[model samples]
Target: MYQTKTKREKIKLFLIILIPILITQVSMYGMTLFDTIMSGRAGAADLAGVAIGSSIWVPVSMGIVGILMALSPIVAQMVGAKQDQDVPYTVQQGIWLSITIGVIVSILGFIFIDPILSFMDLEPRVQHVAKYYLISIGTGIIPMFVYNLIRCYIDALGQTRISMFIILLSLPLNIVFNYVFIFGKLGLPAFGGIGAGIASSLTYWIALGLSVWIVHVVRPFRKHHIFRSWSKPSFKSWISLLKIGVPIGFSIFFEVSIFSAVTLFMSVYSTYTIAAHQAAINFASLLYMIPLSIAMTLTIVIGFEIGAKRISDAKHYAYMGILSGMFISIFAGAILYIFDDPVARLYATNPEVIELTKHFLFYAIFFQFADGIGAPIQGVLRGYKDVNITFWMSLVSYWIIGLPSGWLLANYTNMEAYGYWLGLIIGLAAGAIALFTRMYYLQHSLQKKLDTQQS
Candidate 1:
């Protein structure tokens, strides 16, 4: 039977999930923040190289991460429905999916990475380092995806604290690795921008190794007998995961690629422009973690309700999550807007980079509302196994509306960097509206059906 949770109880549960996930995300981004700070210290060219290379790597890797993320809701629902026996088999299938996709992507990313960098309009020096950075990191793609698959399984089991602690551990370890490789500390050779990539590669591996140890040794996971037997890859299981996963992957791809595309467009300007763009966007992403973590938790929470055959309860708590996200956005936006200058100073030392980031930050601040609203709604919908509409909606909002407008404004008008950010505002807003509308309609439709069944 589905256990009923009070409204206050739901909010409390949301907080329990939100804080650890937030720390985990913060720790995850802490790695990037460290890389960005270190890159800035290296040189403008080093910073730009990392930014450009990240533009390529982040989106490509996110596509795989997004697809694998489908595992969260699936596993959450299964656990909720008391199909605990299926969890281990489901994990095996996820591993198979990760390995299959990981091998292909890692190979292609390595072969094509240099050629792609060669075509970009980067400063030759920046291009050279960016190519090295991509290659250094590209080799670790499979391990990273496998780690994410592991993370999904653990988080679905309400063991979020495990992922949080592991990421926290990786932060200091990554810094040490970066120090040794990037600065020739501790008898290591200085690799500069490439060193950060190498550090991240090593960090993912370390974290993965630790995760395996924790799962095997920890008392909680041993109960599942998750590793007692390995299941062969099944085509049917692949199709099942892919059906829900592909759209999610594409949706994230569209969103992240558009942002990455803007970074490429920024390259047309001075190196400082791109560096400043990187700083502002990275800071914006930090604030975005609030809603994003909340969104991730909503999937598990609402999926649990759905699996327990509590549609109304799922819908109720889903709104609570969405509202919480919006509330947090208001505070986060205010903080960014009010303290923009000091925050920009944290990423860069140059006056021009600082000023430019300050100006562009307005759009980033304004869009948080839309991002917050859209993000959690989509998370709830994912729990309901609804993704196709989101994929199509994102394509329209980001590609059709956001990127083109950004390009036109940055190129044709005097907006330049400012224009691209303005386009971000519009794109985020459209996505928010579309998602909200879809959820509203679906909720009422489900309500009517439930009412009829009762009658």
Candidate 2:
């Protein structure tokens, strides 16, 4: 039977899931933040190289991550419907899929790394660093995917705190690795920008090890007997996962690629501009973890409620999640506005880089507002498994409307790099409206169906 949670109970539960996921998300992003900071300390060439390399790597890898993200809602609904026996099989299949995609993407990265960097027409120093950075990071892609796949499973089982702890433990080690590799500490050769990738790769492997240990030793996860039962590779299961995962993967790719595209566009300017763009966007992403975590929690909460046939509870959580996201964005926006200079100073010592970064942060304020609304709605939509429309909407908003408009303004008008930020604002606002309308439609449709069944 579906358990009906009270509004206060729902909010409490929401925070329980949201907080650990927030910390986990933040800790993961922290790895990238440190990479950028450490690389910057190495030099502008190193910083820009890592930034460009990251621009290429993040969108591609995250698209794959998005594909794996489907496991969360898939597992949540099964848990809600009391299908515990099937959870292990579902996760095992996800593991199979993760390894497959990871290998394919890793191979593609190595093959295309040279061509992609060559096409960018970057300075020789920057190009060399970017190439090696991607190669180093690419080595750990399989472990990273497997780790995230397991993370989705664990989080779906309401053990987000465990996932949070795993990442927290890894964060300090990632810093140590970065310090040792980037600066030749502890008898290691200095690799500069490449060290960031080496550090990240090592971190991924360690996190994967810890995740495996947790699933084996942790009481709650051990009960699932995920390892005790072995399931053969099933094409049926792969199709089931891909049905939900593929669109999600593409949707994230579309949204993230726009930013990557912008970074590529920025490369035509100066090394200082690319470094500044990376810094501003990096911090903005850190702040974005709030709404994103809320959204992810909604996916779990609402998916479970929906699976249990508790429509009202799902709607309630969605409303609460969206409102909470918007409220937090307001506070984050103020912080960005007030602390832009200080924030920019954190990323670069070069005066020109700092000044350019401050300008980008100003534009990020508007970007955050739209994302606050849109991101949680996305979580709500994912909870409903209404992903196909999202993929199309994201394609239109980010690629069709956002990128084209930004490209024109940057090329034809005086806005230059700022044009892309305005374009991002416009795109996100449009996406928010589209997604919000879709969420309301689904809620109403579900209510109508429920009322009819009652009558």
Candidate 3:
């Protein structure tokens, strides 16, 4: 029953999915750059403090988002199967689940901010600044998670344009707020790092509110009572989502933890080294959003196809998505390679930091290509609901190989800062290879199953 889409149709679908992802990621990257520029203007201490605070915040937040991603594939499948009525209930269940998890994370994050900063052994000034940053930003966790819930639902329904529009609208506001709070501009008190945190918190909620209003009250999707109905939580639906989501969350956590751990380890180096590391890492993060967006979109698409029982078409779309991602990433990596110096200079004025960051930029370039190759592959596997294998593969790649190798290289070898980045490259390479292997086998098996059933 697989509908073999024409080349024109496939290309149109790919572009439709790709463009919004590109726009959304570019907007987010711009916002990150704006935040860095604002913090850098404040002082090196402020920049470093915000960087550390974000290192802690990003992993946990992404893990929560990952859990919510479980909803996307389910919704996509439902839509593909043309079970339109059930879509709203599934979306509602996802929102409730994300809210519950967000509350727990926010409470724990607020309670442990100080102790965790102490554990990181930050310099006194950095510690003081980070404490303020954490408290202010931690308060926004609920809204942040809530936003993701809405985002996942929209994305599942193939309505990513709204998310892109929201990011574009919110970004300038975030910049303006950061400028006002970080520098005492427009007769506002300079809240320094705390102000930056406050700006992020406020804008996050504003974006969430706007997204909700658009999806629930706007022209097209407004008729759905899923947004208006405050139905009692369904234990069965929650458990189903959780069963699919937790492994996915832990898998994301495992990957992000490697990066977080590297940032923490880099803190032991000189301030110059740390700043350089942050600059390189920041650029890498921006580059990563490209393939990440593609991966997510591909997951939604493949989920829909599979749910329609078009296994062969699902596999084809998955391959096409991964190929497109790889080619784009290769081009992006080349651009990074060529523009590394100018990019680093955009972030920091210090000569030594810029020079050091240039060295690490090479590593970032390599990793970007690897990520482009790997991310969509993993995403396709997720579309197939082959998540448990994906989990084990990530654990083996990151923990078994990445962490120990990084520790040995950074501390035992003479590599130091370079070792930290090298470890990342190695981990990503391992992950890419493993994911590709898994996708190949899974795709083959899926096709064989389809063939047998057809025969």
**Judged by TM-score, which candidate is best?**
2
Which candidate order results from sorting by TM-score in descending order? 2, 1, 3
Which lDDT tens digits does candidate 3 get at residues 348-403? 78888789889989888887888898888878877887788888888888888887
TM-score of 3: 0.96
Off by over 4 Å in 1: none
* Candidate 2 local lDDT, 144-231, one digit each (tens): 9999999999988778999999999999999999999998898889999999999999999999999999998888899888887689
- Give the better candidate number (1 or 3) by TM-score: 1
- Model 1 TM-score (2 dp): 0.97
lDDT of each: 0.86, 0.91, 0.81
Lowest summed-lDDT stretch of 10 residues in model 2? 1-10
Ranked by lDDT, the better of candidates 1 and 3 is 1
RMSD of each: 1.4, 1.1, 1.8
Give the range of the ten consecutive residues with the poorest summed lDDT in model 1: 1-10
Instruction: Please provide, for model 1 over 1-455, each residue's C-alpha lDDT reduced to its tens digit, 9 standing for 90 to 100.
Output: 13556887777777777788889988888877888778877878888999999898888888899999999999989988999888888888988899899899977886797778878788988998788888888777888898898898888877888999999888899999888877778878888888999999999889888888887789677777666788889989989989998998899899888889999878889999998898888888888888889888888888888888788888988888888888999999998889999988887888988998898787888887788898899888888888999999999999999888888888899887889988888898999999999988888888888899999
Name the better of 1 and 2 by TM-score: 2
| Model 1: colliding residue pairs | none
Cα deviation at 426, candidate 1, in Å, is 0.6
